[model samples]
Target chain A: MSNQEILNKLRDTIVTQDIKGCEAAAKEALEADISAFDAINGGLAVGMKIIGDKYELGELYLPHIMMSAKAMDGAMGILTPELEKDKTTESIGTAITFVQQGDIHEIGHRLVSIMLSVNGFNIVDLGVDVPDETIIDEIKKLNGSKVLLAGSALMTTSMQGQKDTMEAIEKEGLRDSVKIMFGGAPISQKWIEEIGADATAKNAADAARIVLKLMD
Target chain B: MTNRMTPPERMMAVMTGQKPDRVPVVPFVLGYASKVTGISLGDFYADGDKCFEAQFASMRLHGYEQTPMYGYASMGAFEFGGEIEYPYGKGQGAPFVKKHPVETIEDIEKLEVPDFKKELPGAYKQADRLASRCSELGLPVSVQVGSTFTAASVIANTSEFVSWLIMEPKAAHSLLDKVCNMFINAIDYFAEKYGAENMLPFDGGPSESNTMISADMFAEFAYPYMKRIHTHLKELGVNSVLMHPCSDQNKNIPHYIKLRNEIGWSGKYVWLFGPETPVKTQVEAFGDHDIVCGNINPSLFITEPYEELLEICGQNILEGMNSPSGFILAAGCEFPPNAAPIKLMAMLDAAEKYGRYE
Candidate 1:
């Protein structure tokens, strides 16, 4: 397949959640001498954007979105080493992801991580149920460089942890050095304002785009 | 001169939109039961008899009107071949993803209708056993059907599930349909053997959390299944349909009320439980169309002193029983296993002191 044809096929396979088709197309794209960046940008990322749009419009559901992400991850796994062979890189900023203390809902954080990683951002995953002090400690370790400090809480009761994390960062004089983003089932724009979050997104795709905007 | 009613009688009166001597206290006591009955979490989940004994013991000890019947976080997902990890502590348990079980489009196409007999006979047997026990004890039993999105999270991982909703819309719908159908079948089987009059309470924990998806996604995914499930339960003669979605479900209250109306459940027959939804909101939105069961934060169980607990319970009774009916005092979610026994006693005492009707 031509490079363009391969990328299009890969995108289609991801949209349909054809895991095998996505893997095959990814390999074919690699063989066609397409750069890793082009394969990701022209094929996977763009396809995911379209899928996300349809989902928001009620054209998609959870299982389908999950399948598409798996397919994209599969294709990305094949392209990462090859992409590293070439030294060209895009600097899309950095994001630190964690689930708030007393909350173990990592699904949102995982989705946000996948979306940001595939869309050309550096992701530092802090895993699930991380404490506020730990987040603050991590931020201080990163010095004064601006990074997206994103937290997710699946429980309404646990959302307080997000607020506490922000407070801890502010106490450490690191709040201004980081931009905070919050999302989860209980999180809302009102919650963002209440918690003093720098930004909030309805879903993972929006989160990535918002983080990019904040970084820029 | 008047006599005091039993916990169940007091609760039933409140449920039926009639004056009770005082407000009934029905705290969510799942883990508390586990602690009281000396039953391990694994056994409580695997055997319905043990669960029944444990729940009944806990309720009897605490003088609660209701007993929490679901065990572990992943019982609903286990019916769909999901694996759950039970952590040994008072902390919330974790669910680990061993595999997707369905990966390719062909896998989706070849999806088998989950056979309860073959797949997870334990779940059905347990439900039946619990129902029988509830009948014998003359105590109402509530069965939990997990939220659609929450169930999907266990089987395919939450991130993967949300991504699929975005990237593979068709496949997502297909999976959701299958999950919903399985849940309906499970509920039908249980209701048939246990009697449809039994309360069918759904535990849609993550969906209500609202941190994972938007209100729009909830309307599209969680609401439809809830309507179908509630409708099915009502058809089986289960008039009371209680939804326990553990987060702030304030945004979706209107949708829940609409579902109740569609199911033909009267105001007194519908119950919505969550931590963030205040009793005032329930009264405002449904207007006695349903009972607002809970908003007592589980944290209070651990944090509050005995006297303070009683005071808070009394205050909640005053605030929640605005209509003198259509209100139940319950923990927002399952009470933490480690809650002070004295706190529960204080709640029951408050009910006794203030719940009596002349």
Candidate 2:
């Protein structure tokens, strides 16, 4: 098969959520001498963008996205080693994602991480119920690098954690370097503005778009 | 100015499909009660008397027409023998599942309907106290009959349970069935204790929303079991039901309407919708038969200016005022626990200013 045909197979595996088929397709792409970078950009990332768009259109749901993520992971497992060997696997930038402190509702956080990672952003998922200090510490470690910090809170009580993290970030002198994006059931553009956040996403796809724009 | 009917009388008028003096404003205030009333969060949840008193105090202080109630969103974990962390620290809300009971698929078989008398003595005792207090005050007794799918998520890891919907259908159904039965049992206990006729079952399905699951998934994983529970509620002679289909659930609205129609719960049924579903849509859908309670954006209470809140509430009231059943202005979900008091007052003021019936 031609290289384009092999790449199409790789993309098909992700869209269909064929987990085992993804690994086979990734290997086929490699065997056909398709560059891992091309296979991902031409194949997997294209498929993920489709998934993201479908999700935004409400044609897909969380479980489907998750399944697609698994398929992406399956393909990435086979392709990452090759991509790293070619020294072309560098990420666009780093993103820190977490559910606010005292809030463990993390489906939103996971979705953001999945969208960002597949879109070539390195994701540092601090997991759920992450403390404000821990988030600030992660931001501090990134130092002078431009970082996208996405925090979410599912409850009204936990929403204050985002504000606390913002204050902590500014105090550490990392405010200018970090662009904070907050989203959740209780978060709105008004809340984001009130808290001085850089952006607020309506959904995971919107989150990727917001992060991409901010990064650019 | 004095109203023709008292708050309770106004609520009853609306519940029974008669136009009230004005639309009742019932914000879904929970832990916010503890915070605003100076009660410790731990005491508010763990102590039923304090919980009841604090909620009452908050209502009276705020001067809203809502009755003080007791229940939490994360209802299954503690009842199922999993540990839960109460919101005692800053930026915390309701009790969350600290440890899920079913860690492995093997644990599914071990799951059983816990005896509220034994396994959850604390919760049972607290609920009993709450019911008794409500009965003493002639208020509707609160029953925690929230969504089984949500509880099932709490019974296991949420992501794991969600994946089980696709990867392990049988396991997901098994867990869902168990939680559904568990909720039914809890309702039965409350019914037997408080008398089902006097009890009001408050159910919110946040995990079942389109944000997490699709309408197709809801039909498969949530609808059948929810139907069973609502059918059981109908059999129990419970007339009043309040359901909050939380967040972006326009797709699932049909299933909910179907469930209500199937059970013939056309009267005294309240749908408190998230802002995602406009109040106009809710009234258009269910207004002919049942009370449509809300569609206010709860987040607006904290962030939006007071005038903006008034406009939103005013628009909702205008859309819902003409429903055949009735309408009550309420927050789409639980009013944010830390939302401003003035914003809540704005909600009530909007109802008073525009909710008056001719």
Candidate 3:
């Protein structure tokens, strides 16, 4: 099959969450002279974008978005080493993911991580129940071109943690360097703007695009 | 003037937006019940009789106004043939899809509309037993119906379900429709058997979680199905249709209020907001449409001291009472099984102390 066809096949496999198919397609694309960068962008990245669009447009739901991320990761498992071997890659973007302290909802943040990783962004997953200091410390460590500070909380009391984390970033003089995106059971655009966040997506796909735009 | 009522009677009154003796306290007490009955969480799920006994025992012990039957995680997938594994002592866990039964459009074509009588008699029988027990105890029984998207998520596997929404909208809708129909049937059977006056169809859709999809998506996918269920329950003589959507669902409360208004169920339906939801904002948004229930952090029951629990319960009841429309004190979600029983009792005590109606 042609390289473009291989890229197209990889996209389909990832979109469909065909884990085995994605891995095989990734290998075939690599063998058929497809550049790792193109394979990552045209194949995995494009498929994720389609998933995101569908998610935003109300076509895709959470479980499917999650599987698509898994599928992308499956393909990435095969392509990551190739890109590292070539050592000729460009940065897509960078994101910081975490479930703020007192909020133990990570399924959403995990999806954001997968979407960002597949889209070629560096992700520093701070893990669940993360404190403000920990998030700031991670941001200092990664120091990516743009920071995607995210939080998820399933309860109202923990909503303050999101506000507190963003406040800490601003207090630490790191607010300008970072772009905040918040989503969870309770977060809203009003709350995001109220807490001084840069942006808030309704779901993970919008989150991915919002982070990319913030980076741009 | 109406005579003052006890906390239980007051709670029932408040649920209908009447002047209760004061604000009623109905702590979400699934785990609290298990602990009260000394039944292991494993026994609660594995044996329906034990689960009902524990549930009734917990409610009676705490003087709880409502009993939340069924785990939030179980409802979403169980009806769709998903396999569930309960870890007993551990909290409720999500049901995993052992088989995708619907792999393609042809598979969808072959899919049969689930016959609740044939398929869910065991569950309904359990519900019947619980309802009977609750009736004997002169308490109310509330059964949970899995939320459409969350249910779909479990059946399709979270990622696959979301992906299918985007990749296969028609198929997703078809699948959701089937699940909705099955739940409606199950709810109707339980309502009829249990008496509609005793039924509360708790739609466990986590649309408010903000993790699943956008408000627009919820308006399309989650809200309509909920409306249908609510409408059907109302028609079946169920006076109250309480929705238990977990998450910071502040944005969606208005939508729920609108649904209640459109369905002419304004005073009858109760919007059970999760503790993660911004209560003040939601109360303000809901503003007299339907009764507002909950926002007590469930974790507090397990973590907080009895005094602290009373203070929070007292404060929430006071706040709700201050409103033109009254409130029902409830946990954000199901009360964790390990929650200190004393704390739940303290909540009841606080309601009795401060929830006195003039």
* Best-matching candidate per DockQ: 2
Q: TM-score of A-chain in each prediction?
A: 0.91, 0.93, 0.89
Compared with the true structure, what per-residue lDDT tens digits does model 2 show for residues B1-358? Answer: 3547778888888887778888888988877788776887877888888888888888788777778677777778777778988778777787778889988788989987777655443365677787789889889987778788887888898877887788889999988888888888888888887888898888876889897889999999988988898889899999888888878889998998888778876446788888889888898888888888867887778878889888889988998888888988998888887777888888888987888885
Quote the positional error of residue B307 for candidate 1 in Å: 4.6
lDDT of 3 by residue, B108-218 (tens): 566565676664632455555666676676666667665766766655545455566656778878877876787787777777666777776667666435546666667
In angstroms, give how far residue A205 of model 2 lies from its true place: 1.2
User: How high is each candidate's TM-score?
Assistant: 0.68, 0.95, 0.69
Model 3 chain B poorest ten-residue lDDT run: B89-98
| TM-score, ranked from best to worst | 2, 3, 1
Winner of 1 and 2 under TM-score:
2
The C-alpha local distance difference test score for the whole of candidate 2 amounts to 0.84
lDDT of 1 by residue, B155-266 (tens): 5555555666656667777877777787777777666666776655555665434444557767876777777776667677776655666566666666766776677765
RMSD of each: 7.1, 2.1, 8.5
